[model samples]
Target: MWLVSFLGKTITAAIAAAVPSCIGPLSENIVYPFKVSDNVRALVLTTSALAAIQADVQEKVENAELQGLVQNNQVKQWLDQVEMVRGELDDIKNRYEKRLRCLGDRSFNCWSNYWISKDAKKKSTEVQELRDRGKFEEVAIQITPQVQEFSVGSDVVPQEEADLQEILRYIDNDEYDIIGIWGMGGVGKTRLLRRIHNHCKRSSDFDVLFVTASRECSVEKLQEELCDEHGFGRGTGVVSQARIISNYLGNRNFLVLLDDLWDQIDLQRVGIPFPLGLVNQFKRKVVLTTRLVSVCGLMEVKKSLKVVGLDPEHAFRLFKEKVGNETIHSHPLISSLAIDVVKELNGLPLALITIGRSMYGKRDPREWEDAIDLLKRSRLNEIETTPEEEKIYYKLKFSFDSLESAELQNCFLACSLWPEDFPIYKIKLIECWMGLGLLCAFDAQNIYNPGYTLIGKLLSACLLEEEGSDFVKMHDVMRDMALWLVHTVGIQGINGLCKRGLELIKCYTREVVGFMQSGRHYLQAKN
Candidate 1:
């Protein structure tokens, strides 16, 4: 029976091997049954084989379903994470883009999506030739154009006359190596220095004459000037050039005008070398003009000058020169007013010159009075009417416009409310300012002790005139200008006061009506 069963099983296997389509049921029933010997064993083997096959098939199907679910979830999760990362990256890109834009308009290329290789080098000759002949040559050869160069004037001036005189005396005494002239703008400083330069040049006190140090003045320019003045070789390098010039000037007496000197300039830095210990080796006199007095002080000169305004007589002469002689007599009434006008000018040469130039050729008394009236009415605006007036207008405007803070401008305009030539007591001015609520937002320190600070800013800027120890005054013209600015700019300092007055009137009216109503109510109650 075992031999017969084995033979049957071998036949079933052969048939299944011949055709796989028949293997499932053949292996499940025929061959599988034959492999078992006893009835019970055969039955158990067949049932167990069928059951194992079904279980294997079911497990494979379940595994396939589970794998599909896992893959779907993984894709969804990965997509969500990718979206989050993408959002973060976008936000970072936007922030940097805004920052780059704020840097300048030239940064627009960063916004355009483009790729530039970090290690890119100039193309080889052959590759460049090919690129030049290619269709993309136009795009490849595109380049940004250079910006246009602009010319600007030097915004520097000379020192005052008193300062000039002091400098002159120092030169005469030969006490110092260099004399420096320094002061702020509109102080007639540059004019004074020029005058000194012209005077000294004519005197023949020095053998060689040269003026250098202009706007953007460089070592090369100085070297060139020095070389040209002494007829030396115009060498290329700064050190070589300067050394050549220094050697030539060593034994010669020279007057060098280093005009418009900036702060913290070292002669050695410009490549000009003199012997270490020789105090007056060349007697090379250098006159420097600068806005900073500290530069002059730093040079440790024997004499320093601080330029100030002219005296009354000099100011009068300066004014008359501007007005011209023909008009001086024809406009006697105007000329009579001229003395008062000069007084109002407060000895400023620029102011006098500007006012006189504005009144030039106009001999009409009415025109003079009108000009004066305009000056009284609106200081800056009146000056704007004529080209001559424009100069004084700009000078005053610099003082007025230099105020950076709006609160400061308000404080300045509030000053215009007072009568012309009125002497302002510091305490009283503070009280008025406080009453007007100007001090509400300011710090306690500024509110309580703004005397020196406020006056100093105004005085230095030439906005307010200092009257004695504790008083302040404004120029009549400046006062009118302030008033005009207040009205035009609609400054809240004066407007706020007017608004408060209106509010108080409204409140009083409301109180009176309420009182009348109460009286009526009392009469009704009594009846």
Candidate 2:
């Protein structure tokens, strides 16, 4: 009996100690409903506090999302719960507003009042808990384990691999904000960027945004793409969109990959956070690929990497791969002749691929010999691109020369009339070809098949690139070559107006700008 009494006394003392710590908060809920008007007032106050916190949290979430970040899972759930609690509170308020009166409308209905009061007290507790939980120190978190995987294939030669490593090192360095990759047209700048983009080893904190600023890419168009990605509405003017983009990207770490940039793009105008100092916490980066070295200087790049032509050994390997072993080994001398062709190509990847595909299945040594002589004679002395780049165009010309018919050649050359990187509409281009007597069929409607056939041949020869079903675009190098041919071969009626080199075009642009500013006028403008 003494042990039983002692055990009961100890248990009672433990229960007394636990009640205040454990059930003290729960006890408030028990008594809150009976407080009537106090419960409703408390509920309103808690709801207001929760709503303010929700707005702040919502703003943080939206800003993070605009910076290309995803919200934390816990944060997302909390938001959902907040929404649910808001709906419940609204229902409680509506029920209280429609309260019934009993005892000849002299007093409130006891059961109805108790029911509404109990729900309000419960919801007030829930809202208070939510308000406390919504006090997040950081509303967004970096997405984890982001792996961008790219195939490191045979196409990425030793030099390119070295270039890739160098770029990766720059990305790792804290100092480099804007890294520039510049080379001649078709020297694999875009390809190198692709490798960098898909590389799985890059930092996961950085959200890589790849934008191709082709020769024809405009600031407005670029903004629209960014706005669309950020879920911002467009048709707002460029300034408004720029402000929106600047505000959104200002808070996040990002890597912007701008490919094939022809001119200096205004980073400020485009709304990309620029000139990111070492002091800045956000480790933002901009990697741009351009053909002009001057553009690197203009953009104030921290480090500039130039992608040059492939070396002779790798060049020949790429050429032979495209030409195939069967064709090269068919005749003993054809292997030696293939080396001569690679030499004429000057190790340019575009030239090598174009000429190699053209030479596929050819077993004749004499044919290879003739190709070498044609390449030797095809060099243009006066051109805007460097002497090295000129070699690429002349080497690519071998493919143009090998096209089956004169009509096909004209049709391919005609595509150069469009600006660089312009997407030439297929049917319109075909109609132009038909108008220019480049293609003929039995009926007007039947000309499309031949036009498409010519386009296929051009695409196969690597002259024209297909841009979806309705459009085709000329590779910048190919367009340059066509323009060179237009000038050199005296394609009548298409003179200096359309025949000048790319550098000459840049010079002309500067001159026109100067002329416009200087108020100069010429009655007769010479081509």
Candidate 3:
């Protein structure tokens, strides 16, 4: 043991004499020129002994100033910083493992869930790109659209504004679950409902749905519309549809507007939860528009509002807007005649706008004079061969007559086959035209172009109004005109068709021998 100690001391002294004090910097080996061997072991031992000897010699010759310069308060601070960085690194490693586990865990079924996979991939790509660009201080934000904006302009009747406020108050006061808007045809009930719907949509508190319940409204259709709105998929039966509606609306704040309801809609059948009060769920309200005041009682509307004519001042303003300002400003004489024409309309919104637009760009006072006389004749039921015509029907006829072609006229009239206030899908309308041979084909154009062009013209003329993206509708009064034209005014030679059943068979495409036999049996039974 003493010989080993003496050898170690002698080796340490020889190394200390050979190397300079800066030998501490050469401890890292740049190359491993030697493999494992006895010489390697001896060299490592000698290097360790030299380090110990150097420490002992520094302790014996230590300068207090040099030691103070080497380490002061900074040593403790450096240690604290090192500990904090180590803790942060450990925290980062732990979070990385947790995230990996979250993605890989089998219990949550993350692999099968499309939304989960989509989110994970999307976030992973986003984080990688962000780290690539070194955008640590900023993060990407994604926004989703839930509420729709109301598209009505500022120019509105103060009455409509008042009506809107009253309607909101009705819901706010919790006064009723359903409200009714009743008006004469073309008196702007639909427009009023649109304004109210816009208000509900702008506020993010409720789920708002607007359904047009035309004369052909059915429980199944209402359910289908509601289901489509809720994205519940096509349910099998009425019961299933109702269940879907209840699930979608039972826990949410919602408003449903049934536009142009011709009759009482079965709320329960359509899955609108009634008797509005509930223990914990949000509020639901229903608003409907109709031409019949009795529909209010049928629908059990707790509050009823009548959409009356616009006041004279608003009516004239609306008329001027329909006619260009340039036309009205061309002459003071025309402006005075325009007021007289609008006054003749008696504040009826539809008639005023239609007539005024028809008179647009006519600077002649004589044309305005002619319109006033015509409007008076129509309103008094004198212009028609029949005496029972409504004023709006004639005014709408005037809009119809302004169309560019007779083909357009035929198209507008063809829409009458659809039920009154019923929405006519553009595609279905074209099919109806082709089935009836109403569309005239040209070589260069496709077969449906004529019908589509006519539809656009009608929509621009306001003879046909859009209900939703896919459908268009004739105003109820316009539909009335169509029914009158087809069934009443054009019914001259159709009464004797029963006597000429054989001739009817010739025009019919398919054989109906069963029908002829049934007729023979009915005749014999009657005899």
Candidate 4:
């Protein structure tokens, strides 16, 4: 019995330790019940106790399964947290990439802006330089008082000497307040005026005699000129200056020569005290030269002299003298052609002189034929077909024929497009010609150079007259000739060139449209 009890106590102690380890301290309080004989009961109780412990172990296993479920829930939460952190990290990376892209675009735009600004500044500087050069050229060509020193020829034995003498006698007798000399261009009107002026200057019958050329003929310009010639300082206004001049010349006998008058004169409107009807106090003799016959009638002069061209015999004599008397006698063909050409020139003194000077050394029949042909062509092609076509065409052709280069010929012909008596701006004219591509073949540096050179050549050839600082004028006949060239040559060539230019502009516009469309599409895709 003692041995069994000792064994049972050892077993019980083992159970207590194992049970606590498996479950908790409360597992030691549990027990198993059984009834049996003393020897058998002890064996049976041991078996029953083992079976109960097995049952307890099954209950502990169920509790352990519950704990395992709680641990699995905690692990799942940790996994969810890791996934959330990964999502936040991804968002940060995307934001940084977007900001970097924007910074790159800004850097590119900065470089493009710099280049655009540089190009604009360069273009502005070039334009300013061109404008300055144009202004300098304008100042250089200004007509001033020094041009009066030009040696205008005198009429020695004019055909209308009797008429001139009669007019002078009438002026001497104070028959008319103003006398007008009417004639066509190059008909010796200026020459006659110069003769009259020289005669008046030699005589002391008048005080304060003055001569001035009326190119613009503006009332203000006339007043300014009067003040300038009479030794007056810059006056306040046109009226004041005119009044001062009238007062100065009121009591004096004066002779004034107004050359190249295009419009009728209004002496009263000019602030001259000379009465609108008639005045005897001033005793002023005003002489004028004009191409208009209506101007002569408007003036209502007491005596008017219509200056006609030289007679055939006189024209031949003038031609012979100019061509050299020796050369005229030696060549009958030359002399005959010269006579025909002069007759064709309508006996105009300038026409005869220009032709005589041009044909001075040339005795070739072929050359003479070429000149005659050109003259005939010019007459047919003239825009304003004057009755004096044979004369005017030949005379004008003589000037053009002397030019050496084809470029010079084209440049001279280009001037014919302007209207009759139109004042041309030199720089504007050059710009027009350049726009027409006339200067395309020239060197880039010499593009404007040709214009300056052509202006000099035209002036030297007497094709252009400098009217003022920035104005040049061509003769009526020369303008007509230019029109003819435009209709015949420039229309066809320039029109084609303009069409090509338009096509090129269209092509560039199309390309720009395509580029713009592509840019818009790219922007849309990015958005």
Candidate 5:
């Protein structure tokens, strides 16, 4: 053994002396070339494992985004590094492939083989490190410091600011669990709820979920919306969905915002751990916005707030702002004309914004004068309504009439056929419009463009509200106006169709039976 070691040392010294600078490469050439194939194999295996983990992380990210959760910054950086490593691996593979071919029992370029093997071994180590790093316990996080800034401007009406503060105080009070915000349609109840949602996100430690309840609010529909937001699938029944929702929410502190609730939705039935006080030592609360004061009582709200319309001064300021300073300054009389318009609108937020937008660039005094005249006529024409309701509906009609085309008007009016606060599916509404011949198609294939275009026009006019990409909704007051236009004004096209359809389908009232009777009478007369 000593003789063999002495011979090995003598050979190594002779080689180092032959070329001192080549010693490093000569040793690596002997050591690494034999391991070249093994290193390449290990690299491929490590990369495959990494790819599998990357796919899992990507899927988790996509699911989290669907639930409105943001990914953690470290997770995002690791994903970026994974992509970069993939590019580097590709380069390494290409360089290895370009190496000189090996002949039987000998390499054509030993140095090339040695370098390629060395690079593969190093990259395999790095790839394995990345694989281990990718094993995260939590990949995504809830939106942090969740307060999103709303640009309501510095001129927020004092009443609204006060209302928001009062509501926040109620929210802080543990005794008030179910808080209700009730007001006339377009009086800013929904806006107040949104502000409260933002406030909860900022100040509170609870997980905040803001949802718009259906107009025909049902426990099942509410459950479905909540389930969708939480990435929960629709279960076998409401009971199952509720159980899943209850289990998930029961684990955390939660604040739920339910907007535009027209009727009472049972909190417990929708999967909320109600009376929230019993929630496993965690805090939970429900805040809702509704048009009906009775709904507040029906929901057993601890405290209910009435969101009143803006005062006259704030109303005029809001109108002028929406009308633009340029238009208001165009003629000295335009501002006064705007004040007249505001008076016609009755300090209602929706009417003010809609009418003001419609009058945005009208520099002509006659245009303002004409708008005022038509608004008065619209108000005078309506009957069987309270003063406040009458003002909003008729003032909204001016915007409806200002729709650039008759098709746009009909399309806007058609939305009112569904139940109040119901999200009318866009495709279904367009199909109905096409069936009614409201959309004149150049060809069968070309039909959808006109339908979507008309819907877009109505949306721009604020006559129709967007529920999501899939649905549009008509405000309750706007629907009432459409019905009024049909029954009282006798428009006789889509309007007539809406009234007849609503009576027959939505309401099993005397009007429906009367319509069938009238149809029989017409048939008898013809016979």
Candidate 6:
């Protein structure tokens, strides 16, 4: 009897020890009914604290030593590697802990204990690994965050993988030399360049610098940006700036993207080595966006890619995204009409977005109908756009202004005559242009080559889009702008006023902004 009592006491003590460990921390099994709440909470807190420390140390190692650590650094790479490992361990802990809460009241079952023990073991292993890595010391070295936000958020439009891949290929491949993304002003060249820039920075294959060329960019400004990217202080003279930028970049594998390049940029003046010499050493690349193919030729690009507008289905998708369904789907008939109007937009994304947003939040189809009508008739000036839409018109107009010659400008405006989204046959367009006396440089029958060339120039400038093999179509916005320009600038509107026997058209600049006195001058202008 004494022996039986001793054995019972021994077994009871063994079960008591196990109860607080696996089953009690797990909090599900009724068999192990003791409250070990303090122990469980302490363990959970300890694990989280360790993780926090690891993160703190990693950030310090990054910010202190690695300037662009997230983009390129051994410390960043090691932290990422450790994080992935910890993530799997975290998944295991989460699954078991969640199940521990949901487990049924099966007192005799060993399965509960089995899962609880496994979870405990995993946590222990994780904590040990972190401890071995010197987590506490590393985090304690830097205890506070220096920035207001952990990371900035960006929303990029869904881009075609093919285009991005093509860009990546060019940037990576040793075969290609200079890469140029040539398109019209508002065709998302800058956006594409941004995407490429971000990717290259993250990839860390080559150092990347992005520079924007304005209508009046100075050599000193260009030199300053290059120097800054390479960690050189500003220099006073243009030559000094160039020298600093060149000496820094001469030996490194780097990419310099000059966005919105107007004329040929002298990279030599910017302290950039010639492409041939750099290609031989570091296999670096130079990418730029411009409206002119002639600019590509002047820069001597080996590969040039055209950025075209979105397709019909994707165009409507973007339009709907901007407008939302409430405006278009408010009526069945109006939805159909909206689709047709979107088609007339000729799949230009920027125009669709601008026009769509102007019609946002309106439930009535009449507002939409008015929008369609205005879009059809008015060119650049007369259309009613929200404040944000002004930028679009400005950019599109810049492309218009960038035309090489006045003849090309007139030829583009003449395209406004065709109805919205109407495909103009090459032969027919050339004939019209021929009689307009713009294509007089080439014979009417021989107009094919020059006509094709002119069409290409217009298309490359994003003034027009290709419809098919032998025809072209202007974007609805482009056509509207053309007509608007003609009416306002061609004296057609003034001619109409003169036909009605109204004499003088007074133009005022200094009196008030955006003021025009044409119809019986409201304040008796003295011009």
For model 5, residues 1-527, the per-residue Cα lDDT tens digits are 44533554465456556655647777645557555656777888899899999999988875664444556889899999999888888887787677635432223465776787888899998898999999888877764323343333456689999999999888788888888899888888877777787777777777888777855568887877775555553456887667656656776788889998877667898788755843567888888888788989998889999988889999999888888999999999998998998988878988998888899899999999999999888755656655655556667778877888777777776665555556788878887676555776787777688888888877876778777677787777777777666555555444232244335343222232234334431111110
Off by over 4 Å in 3: 1-150, 278-281, 330-332, 380-389, 419-439, 445-453, 466-473, 489-527
Residue 505 in model 1: lDDT: 29
> TM-score of every model?
0.39, 0.62, 0.60, 0.51, 0.61, 0.46
Give candidate 5's TM-score. 0.61
**Candidates in order: C-alpha RMSD to true structure:** 28.8, 16.0, 22.7, 37.2, 14.2, 23.2
RMSD of 5: 14.2
- Each candidate's number of clashing pairs is 7, 0, 0, 2, 0, 2
Q: After superposition, how far is residue 453 of candidate 5 from its true place, in Å?
A: 4.1
Q: lDDT tens string, model 6, 1-527?
A: 44533554465466666666655644333323221222234445656776776677655653432222112234344456556656655665564455443223222234544554455555556665665664332321211112111121253445544576788888777767688898765566766887787777777667677777754455766776554444453445776566556545666787888887768877888767665424556866788888777889988888889887777777788778767887778777777777866865666565675556555666777766765665555355544553432334543454475577777877786666555445678777766566555676545566468877888878766577776577787755576566545544441211111112354333221111122213222221111
Per-candidate local distance difference test? 0.50, 0.73, 0.61, 0.54, 0.74, 0.59
Which portions of model 2 miss their true places by more than 4 Å? 1-154, 200-203, 216-218, 225-232, 277-280, 379-388, 443-447, 467-471, 492-527
lDDT of 4 by residue, 454-486 (tens): 777677556676766676777654554444434
Global lDDT of model 1:
0.50
Q: What's the best-to-worst order under TM-score?
A: 2, 5, 3, 4, 6, 1
Least accurate stretch of 10 residues (summed lDDT) in model 4? Answer: 135-144
Residues 1-527, candidate 2, lDDT per residue (tens digit)? 44533554464455555667567666544443334445676898899889999999988877665554557878889999999998888887777667634322111355665677788888898998898898888877654323345444556799999999999899879888899999988888888987888872364667677777877677897887665444443324777566656656677677788888988788888877666734358878889999889999998999999999899999999999989999999999999999998988777888898889899988999999999988887764435655656666667778988888777777777776565556788887786566545567776667588888888888887788767667787888898788777655444331122113353232222233233224342112111
